[model samples]
Target: MNTLLEQLKNKRLVWQANQQNAIANTDSTGYQELDVALHGGFPQQGVIDIDSAVGIGEIRLLLPALRARQQQTQRQLVFIAAPMQINGEMFAQAGLSLEHILIIQPETPEHALWSAEQCLKSGCCHSVLLWHQQLEVAQAKRLQLAAEQGDALHLLFRHKRQLSMSLPVNLAMKLSPHAQGLSVQITKRKGGWPDNPFQVDMTKAWPTLTRVRHADNVIQLPQSKVS
Candidate 1:
C-alpha cells in the first residue's frame, strides 16, 4: 500500500483535501480589491463568464489581466464578435500589444462559437474574448475543454440576467456599473465561495470613467478640459 501511494503521488494523481481548498494558480488582476476577493487574481487559464451589459467598464476591468496573460505566455489575444470596433488606443493604454491582437467577426453565432473554439485550441493565443449572448451546456463545455487543451483563457461576455441555470466554467460573475467602477457579484467560482457584491474601484486607473459623489449625495463626472 505504501508503494502504491508513493507511485500515485509521483504521478501527480494524489492530493490532500486541503490542497483542493487551497487557491489555485492565478495571475494578478491589476486591481488590488479584485485580487483579494479572487484569492489571488483570475485563474491562469480557464473560462471566465462575465454577465454584464456592454460598454460599461466590463472590458476595462479585464484588460490588465489579459495583457498580463499575453505577456506571460507570449501568445496572441483574440477577440471574436465584439459588439463594437476594437479600440486600439484604450487597449494600448492598458499595455496590451497591438500587434499581438486579432479580431474576428463571425457572420452567425454558430460561426462565432467555431471561431472561438479554434482560436482557443490553436495553442498560439493566450486569451480569447468571445462576446456571445447565448450558449448551451455542451457548447460551453467544448470551449472549456479547448481552453484546457491549449492552455488559454476564455472570456465569455453576455447580458446580465437572472441565471436560471449555470454553465460549466471556472468562474462566473455578474457586473453592474457603480460610481467608483463596477459592482461585482461572484455567482460561482471553482475553488472558492460565491462572493457578496464588492466594489472594484477604477477611479485611480480611470478617473474620467467613474462618477464622483459629493458630501450632499450628488454625483457628477470630473470635467475634462476642452482641447
Candidate 2:
C-alpha cells in the first residue's frame, strides 16, 4: 500500500524516538506573538494542531498564511473538511478567490489523512488543511512524519478537549470562539516556551492578524543549556 505512513528502509521508524525534536513549521499565522511562541508558526515539516473549543480566531489565523500561499503560488488551496462548511465567498472576501481554493471531501479520517498525505507528498499542491475529530496518536505521528517527508505544511483541527500530551505535534494550541473575537491558547511548545501566550481579537474587514506588539518576526528563544 502507498501509505502516507511510508517507512524509510534506511532509517527505521523506531529510530525516530531517539532523534532530537525538530520544529515543524513557522510561517506567519499573521499573529506575531503566536508566531513567536510557535517559533515561526508551525514547524517547517509540521503537524500543527488547532484544538478549538470554538473556532473563531482559528479561521482568521489560518487565512493570512493560506492567502499568502495562494498569492505566492497562484494555485488553489487544497482544503479537505467533512464539517468545515466555510462559505467560499467569505474566504474570497478575505482576499482568497474562491476559484483559487480546491475543496475535497473524504469519507473518513483515515481516508482524509491518506489523501492529505498523498497530496502533500506528491509535491503538486501548496498546502493542506484538514479537520478530523477522531484522529489517533499513531495516525497523527504518521501524518507528522509524512508531512515532514513531503515538505508540506499541515493543520490538524481537533476539538479543544482532545488536545493531549501523547502526540508529537510541532505545536498544539487551543482555540476559544467568542461573541466578539477569538481567544487562543498556545498550550504546548517543544524546546521552550514562546515569550508569551497569545490572545488575538479576530479582525473583520479583511485578512489581518494584529499582534501584541508590532508584527515583528524575530523571537528571543529560551536560553540554550550548555554542558
Best by TM-score: 1
RMSD of 2: 11.7
RMSD of each: 8.1, 11.7
The per-model lDDT (C-alpha) reads: 0.87, 0.66
Q: Write the per-residue lDDT of candidate 2 for residues 136-162, one digit (tens) a residue.
A: 778877887777777777787778444
Model 2 TM-score is 0.71
Superposed by TM-score, candidate 1 places the C-alpha of residue 62 at a distance from the truth, in angstroms, of 0.6
List of clashing residue pairs for candidate 2: 24-43, 24-44, 25-42, 25-43, 25-44, 26-41, 26-42
Please tell me which predicted candidate would have the highest lDDT against the true structure.
1
Structure candidate 1, residue pairs in collision? none
Ten residues in sequence with the least summed lDDT for candidate 2: 8-17
Off by over 4 Å in 2: 1-25, 163-165, 194-197, 204-227
